[model samples]
Structure formats: C-alpha cells, structure tokens
Target: MGRRTLVAVARPDGRYDCRIAHWGVGADPIAQSRPLGTGLTASAARTVIDATYDQLVVLDGAVRTYVVCWLDPTLSDLDDVVLARTADPDAFRRWWVERKDEACRALDSDGCDPATVRRALLTSLRNRASSVHCLDDASFLRGDR
Candidate 1:
C-alpha cells in the first residue's frame, strides 16, 4: 500500500483548526492547527473544512463540539485531505445549512464573503477529478506458426 496522508479539523476551544498526518509504514502523523481566517464564521469555516475531507468525526467536550476531518492521501487527494466534523454529522449539517444565508450575507457585506470562499472550495473540489487512460500493448499476442 502507498503512503496515505491525513488531515483533521477540530474545534478545541470554540475555534476552528486543522491538522495533517501521513499514514504509512513508520509514517508519523503531522498535525497542525489552522486559522479560520478573518470574517469567517464558525459555521462557514466548518463547511469549508467539511468539503475537503473524506470522513468526519465529531466529539462532545465540556462546552463545545469537536469537528475532525480524516483523510488517506494514498487513496485520496493529498492537498485536498480534510478533517471536518469529527463529532456529529447531523449537527454539522444543520449548522452548515443554517449558515448558508449568513455566509452569503457576509459575502455581500464588504464585496467578499463566506459564500465566495465556499464557491472557491466547491470549485477546488470539482477540479480535483482524476482519470485513467490505457494505451495499446502487445502483451496479449502469442507466437503463430
């Protein structure tokens, strides 16, 4: 099996962050915290992060929900790996759905908004298509008398 890279998104203290790790023989997981950036709401950040990861795991803590996005790059996009909702998918979905309007509003606020970010994210997802092509070969040919 090839090396796999993993990315995680977690909210430790009411703030959104992301981490990345490599999965393979003797591979060490590299985790890091990501900034939600300015003008991005928690819901918007979650949505963006969710779209990047293959699986999400949610955990309940003292006063907040932890959203984790896990990815295996050997079978997925290395740069596109994500750790989105690591606790509750239902809650994350609801939060993202409700915040769509707010994200749009934010986009219109200062000529830039979360919707723009969302759209960019969508585009990135759409652009990551992979295709396979095969060429003619003579491996199937046998000697004829």
Candidate 2:
C-alpha cells in the first residue's frame, strides 16, 4: 500500500463512521456518513470497522475495473469481480463486443453456453435497478456519463 486509506472508522463511543480518507493526509472528505451501530464493545466496533472497510474496497474495485474496461482494451483479466460491477445490459454488451473473442474462448473452456449466459447476465442487470424512474437508461450505458 502506498498510503493508508480509511473508509470506515471505529469511534471510541461505540459507533462507526464511514468516510473517504485523503491519501497520506488525516482528513477525510466524506460524501455521507451514518452511525454503524450503538452500544457496541471495543472489539465489536473493531469488527464492524474491518468489515465495512472490506466492503468499500470491493465496491470501489469493481467500479474502477468496469470503467477501465469501457475506456481501454483490457491488459488485465476482467474477472467476476470486475464483471459484477457492470449492472447495465447495454454497457455490458458493449464490453462483451470489445472482448468477444476472449470471452468466448473463456466460456468454451469453462463448458458454459455463451448464449445462455449472455441472456442470464442481461436479465440480472435489468433486475438490479429501475432505469425508468432512477435515471435515463442511456446514461447507464454511456460510460462517460
């Protein structure tokens, strides 16, 4: 690690706060925060802090990995961790087009049917959010937005 990043912190009074750590600096520029819990012991607060930090890391990793795939030809393997972040079908299909040959090869090696998996992934993304009320369907597909 280059510098410490604290996503969620354990407070002495038995609650946790989630904040974004400024790299190499102590101040955190937080978007929002809420108390993790109340009436917790020191060890329990520590456990909550650790778990919340891990979750934040995974969420951020997935987001960046997906964005990179959209912007460039991937040099790294786009594993399940990255793929899970692409919750929009149009965006994901675009990603699929960029690496079709590679993806197909992988699918074949795993003995999975490409057509079936493609449909499944599309359905899953569709089920994730209400694009009609939440945001424009096109915006989700457009990575630059």
lDDT of each: 0.32, 0.33
Q: How many residue pairs clash in model 2?
A: 0
C-alpha TM-scores of all predictions: 0.24, 0.22
lDDT of 1: 0.32
Candidate No. with top lDDT? 2
Candidate 1 lDDT by residue in tens digits, 21-99: 2222121222222223433334544444332333322222221222222222122333333223223444553444344
Worst 10 residues of 1 by lDDT: 136-145
Give per-residue CA lDDT, model 2, range 1-145, as digits (tens).
2222234343455343434333322222243333344454434423332211211211121221121121112223222212223334345445544554455555667776655555454454445423211111212222223
| Model 1 regions lying over 4 Å from their true place | 1-81, 113-145
